[model samples]
Target: MSENFDLIAVSPHPDDAEIGCGGTLALLSEMGYRIAIVDLTNGEPTPFNDDPQVRLNEASKAAKILGIERVTLDLPNRKLLDSIEARMILAKELRRMRPKIVIGMQGMTPRASPDHYQSQLIFDAAVFYSRLSKWEDIFDGLEPWRIENVFYYYTARELLTQSQPLQFTVDISTHFETKKSALLAYKSQFRAHPSYNPPIIDWIEGMGRYFGSLTGCKYAEIFYGSNIMTMNLFKHILD
Candidate 1:
């Protein structure tokens, strides 16, 4: 409906995208993709932060560090829901941006904010609502734009599920430091207190290396999708 983006990563909150798939975003940006991150909420009223604008400023800095565009929606932060209103609001953004691919924050983080799960539902519904036929009135008269690919990125603390969908890995060995820098940009979330920040940063490193080992790489991020991916293995295997 408006500017076209090659890829869009939908985050439930400001730092969600960075923690989930920042390295992939950096890699994609370096490979010349027009990428944008759409944050469903500005992530406010946290234990560490009192001002909501600080979260927005941090998101902007993270986006800059990753070398990508960022957008913050007016949706509720902690109390986010997958209601019809939320669906329409996110669908409007999808219609406006018209991205070919969308990577959504996936899985339920019960130990963390429940907004993560609701955000996943909202992301799923909005992607469907965005491509509906003759629903121009619902989407502010914007034309229906079908997203070609929909994938999900794992969150920080997600519930383990036996029904995990088809999964793949994106090698981020080269851009992993960029990802760390982007995530660290959110100082409010990763403050340099004696007990808070160090372990989290170490976890990030361990997680990336673990996932990368799955694909025989030094560092990588995992992605999940409902659709079957077609690929020729011979093309990637260099003797």
Candidate 2:
């Protein structure tokens, strides 16, 4: 949590990170970005397991599969509140990571889960954390970290709204298997989800194809971001 993370992906649960941005993470790691993942909860009380330690172990394995540092905030399962204390805890971690770019669940489409609301609250807090001077003693001398970009990842939402794409969609056809392998590492989640019936690998491949069709690729992963995303056009230079 203390290192300067070049890319930070926050998830409401263990597998949410991999499901939402696994391919993107692989692409980013290949491009040489130091990536980190933050899991807000242990994802307990699911049919997969009743023990918190079991879920944590699965998350650890998933992180290893994805090849990124992982941190868990240990928030309660199914019940999360965006209190000042919670915000401060998040701020402390953000300060520790010192990430240049922050990505989190949009939680925009599904307004049902408290975890979703918590994710949004974390996203908002991290965005403005560095600006405020008033904070706990933990943030005493921590310099304000103004992340260059904030990307809202689409997950649960079936329809993508019309908006400018800040991040280029990467064709994940080559890495589709790898992405699935990483996601399946979270045994607690995919084990129970009926949608993942046939096989996780097959499921991801189909998903990649569906998303890739948007950009003329056989398989692709999309991202929304904003940090000088525009490209310069020239006859000789490629965009």
Candidate 3:
């Protein structure tokens, strides 16, 4: 039987969730939330990473750092397509995990990798498909499950050109270091390749601090929700 989760982050590649929402995941885990990340691709054949096994190991290590589970789907890297088959596969997983909150990349990322946008479409469709009673037979007869919330997390690659206003910010000040550790675990993709990219860790830290300043926190992560969120009380509001 599949384990249920309070939150599930859908990523285009193995390290995307770590790069975009690692601190948030770590904070949630510390708060005793059952969280998991589903990577659409293995993020292989990169400039520095040619071995799929190495990338898998790195993803596992990163998940451990955030105290969450990680599952990778058999999707082609750099060739993601938003089709019915793709949506059904993801929908099945959603039904199996039954997460209340679903996190995915922003839907309109024209400048970033195409896979990011494609991933958004896949998740968007899967969320709706997961709740279709007629598809229960196709999805292993699992009960229809509807996600309560769908949030989009920004990636470091889109930081410079991101224009979407933040719907809310998560105060991950305490889990900043935990996020860093998870990102650094992908040494093959970020640190090991000296010429592949600059100091991404520095950029991630700077981004966190910038977002935190906006919400009066030491470090934070921002997200956009598809629907307006209602708060019954002001106790959870940040200072």
Candidate 4:
């Protein structure tokens, strides 16, 4: 929380944001937008990753690659629960950051990780609770703030067979390489066991290209929103 940010991306693990929306973040950072990531967990104690500090270092490198600030909460990995305590902690961070746009996990994963859905629930609750004037006593001395927009990014382990339509697609052809670099920063997760893991980098790049083709771009990232966004017809729709 150094200064107010234009956007904040909430992630379940250290590399989740980079895997899902790194290109969008890199593009925004190049446009001089202040972007930050709030990681729900340190993403450690896995078969390959033992030290949490190593993961933090990797996350820091990824954040630097994307030119964004990163913060990690002390939540348990693989066991994140959607509780009031969790919501309040996230709400305090949201109040401190005061981002206009909030991006979080889609939470519609076919994977068995409950942390994904819990992260989504926490983001939903924190957004609403951060605007509560009555919670002044709980969230330090920060003022109440309401987010302008809420969006969801994809980070499922497997390719989705069916899903809801994307609200929008961001053309990230120019920034796709940057996104790859950020993803590569997590060596412990993706590159540690090349033989055991599928070609994750290739899959990520292919996914971007596939989404890009849908929007007539070379590379892109898809996003979903529950609420309709009002836009200027002449400025955006036509142009």
Candidate 5:
């Protein structure tokens, strides 16, 4: 599996990438870019699910719906940490995949699992480690690969107005249903109990519409990046 990817989204859990950026990923996949999701953990031991494999099944279904691939690491769920081990594992995957663009979940969710925050830290380091030349010996002899960009996606856990200076929204009006269907595949999570999940559908739709309004689209997904964007011409910006 030494093939390269156009984009790889790193997530703390299975349903995270779906919730945060499935629409945008689906759109990119439809555009003929090879997209994949690298799940840091399988997101097991939740109150709703018993079998660990169930999450993987749901994650696969979601990936199929998005037309992308899924890779789950054997990292600790719920107890995930941003340690050197975690960084190295993810960096090795990044080197193997050689994705041009890397996406990760952003923001801290104190009310939710602590893995979200640590996942961000791990992602930050993994992207950095993936580009380190001399450290290839530690990664099973995989060659160093420099990712062109690192972007971040977020869910309702973060504020509506992102503080990041380099932020933009992707129009997902045509793929909004695709995103919703992918999220719904996780029956063990959203449909575990109607009262357990916080109206996830509404939350998704609201965020989509809110960002869409900002970008003059029907539905959208916002992303934050570390790079400063440059426009070559006004026509591209106008379009």
Candidate 6:
């Protein structure tokens, strides 16, 4: 768990990461931490032009806006299966990246989306496999890697129901707008559809503003973890 990465966010689909923690990611990147986003699925069933190349281009542009690196796993979106094969693939990625903090949607419940469960499986495998020695074979015999902490952001489930309080909330007063702007890049996913009411873009933006108000910021993101995140108290908290 000694490897240092500012943050590694795993998403079930292309836009899940941004919708959940875009504000936090923007703030973290500004603070000089190396950031990475991994999209576990290719999101084929999404209401787009049905071209993988187009989605890839959109994702890349969005990553550029946030100043973070992006990686797509090409996993099937609606049909994500958390099998042993899937875990091994994610395990290899974790070992290669060696992130300090891992964040994702807690696959705690059977959600309507297969993407959710798929992400949960990846997160589950990543947490432990990243630290194991034998898993090195999964990543071309590379050295084992362990992240310092794991935090699950509130996306589908409420944080308090499953985990303790987050060590702290990111004050996204400055980055919230930028984060929203980045999210707008995925126009294909958020447009008003006949079946999908409550357009996602509107909902996500409102959630950011609402969260930000809690910490005196115009917009913000929330994260929760089971472990205590220690700080210098006086210095880190004040700063």
- Report backbone clashes per prediction: 0, 0, 0, 0, 0, 1
Q: Give the C-alpha miss distance for residue 46 in model 5, angstroms.
A: 0.6
Regions of model 1 farther than 4 Å from truth: 192-198, 230-239
Model 3 vs. true fold: TM: 0.91
Per-candidate alpha-carbon RMSD to the true structure: 3.5, 4.5, 3.2, 3.2, 3.1, 3.7
Kindly list the per-residue Cα lDDT of model 5 for residues 1-239, writing each as its tens digit.
Answer: 57788889998999888988999889888878888999999999889899999989999999999999989999999899999999999999999999888889997887889999899999999999999998868999999999867889978785444468887888889999999999999999998897978877998999899989997999988888877654211113223
Candidate 1's C-alpha lDDT? 0.84
As a TM-score, model 2 comes out at 0.82
The alpha-carbon deviation from the true structure for residue 67 of candidate 3, after best TM-score superposition, in angstroms, is 0.3
Locate the minimum summed-lDDT window of 10 residues in model 5. Answer: 230-239
Q: Judged by lDDT against the true structure, how good is candidate 5?
A: 0.88
For 1-239, candidate 6 gives per-residue lDDT tens digits of 23345678998877778877877787778777788898888676765457777777778877888888888997777888888777777777787787777788764545447568667777888677768886555568867877656777666443245445544556667887777777777655554353564466567667877777777867767766666654222124224
The residue pairs that clash in candidate 6, if any, are 5-100
TM-score of each: 0.92, 0.82, 0.91, 0.91, 0.94, 0.85
Per-residue lDDT tens digits of candidate 2, residues 1-239? 25687778888888776877787677666656778788777777876576878788878887777777789997776887677667766777778788777778765445335677577786778668755665545585676677756776655443446555565555777666667888777666676565644455666666678779977878776566655443121101111
TM-score of 4: 0.91
lDDT values of the candidates? Answer: 0.84, 0.69, 0.83, 0.83, 0.88, 0.71
Clashing residue pairs, backbone N/CA/C < 3 A, model 3: none
Off by over 4 Å in 5: 159-162, 230-239
Q: Give the Å shift of residue 1 in candidate 3.
A: 3.0
Better of 1 and 6 by lDDT: 1
lDDT of 3 by residue, 149-234 (tens): 78888875654354655377788889999999998898898889757576877789898999899879899887877566432111
How far in Å is the alpha carbon of 144 misplaced in model 6? 0.5
Summed over model 3, clashes come to 0
Off by over 4 Å in 3: 159-166, 229-239
By TM-score, is 2 or 6 better?
6
